[model samples]
Target: MSIEVGSKLQGKVTGITNFGAFVELPGGSTGLVHISEVADNYVKDINEFLTVGDEVEVKVLNVESDGKIGLSIRKAKEAPPQEREQRRPQKRSPRNQGNNRREQLSFEDKMNRFLKDSEERLASLKRNTESKRGGRNTKRG
Candidate 1:
């Protein structure tokens, strides 16, 4: 059977490497599922997820010009119900979770912090400008 992009196919894991797994499709065609495409979460090792002779469902991502087909295992699996629920925005309490005893900063406190930061920045800029101007004063007698 001819495999096209977005086509789902059942394939056997023929080889496993650090980067990806090689799957043999029905038509004797081999495709590569890159490590990044192996799972929804971070996959540190490909072997942890797949082994030789294991049957897996994969989605054909692309068929390169050189006849190499790219497959994705993560894309083939349907999203879990919990994942769908988590995608929705969650309601949060107005109170801060950590440091319950610590009160929120007052407006004056915020203004003071901003002014202190601005003063330090201005001082640094003045120092840089003075250094640049001083460096230009070197002259031959």
Candidate 2:
């Protein structure tokens, strides 16, 4: 009846909280399954997954010398199909992938485009900057 690290056990959930669920092990001690350990997905609420008196299979993650036990319900279950999806890399944006349309432009073409953009931005800045500071006071004293 000893609860060892890395062991799997069946337990009845005795209580539920925003942070986690408390389960009473067959060996007569209770442990917590933290919200993060309850599932592989983003669990915004632990109550959605477990309830008081619900039986769960949990893997013993650790047993501290001070007697605090760490458990994981997700670890005891087989690899879920969604696990593969999460493991696969997400689709990257085309901009990040180095397939930028600008890359197709020749060096001279790029320089020309840059010069044109710079001129336009500088012209806009010059027009707006003076207005933001206000025109000189032309009123006669």
Which predicted model would earn the best TM-score? 1
Instruction: Write down the lDDT of every candidate, Cα atoms only.
Output: 0.90, 0.88
Model 2 segments beyond 4 Å from truth?
80-141
What's the residue-level lDDT of 75 in candidate 2? 90
- Span of ten consecutive residues with least summed lDDT in model 1: 94-103
User: In every candidate, how many clashes are there?
Assistant: 0, 0
List, residue by residue over 1-141, the lDDT tens digit for candidate 2: 789998899999999989999989987988889999999999999989998999899999998888788899999895667997898779978766786666888999999999999999998987777666674533334
Model 2 worst lDDT run, 10 consecutive residues: 132-141
Candidate 2 lDDT score relative to the true structure: 0.88
Top-lDDT structure, candidate number: 1
lDDT score for residue 89 of model 2: 74
> What's the CA error at residue 90 for candidate 2, in Å?
17
Say what the RMSD of model 2 is.
10.9
**What lDDT is reached at residue 101 by model 2?**
68
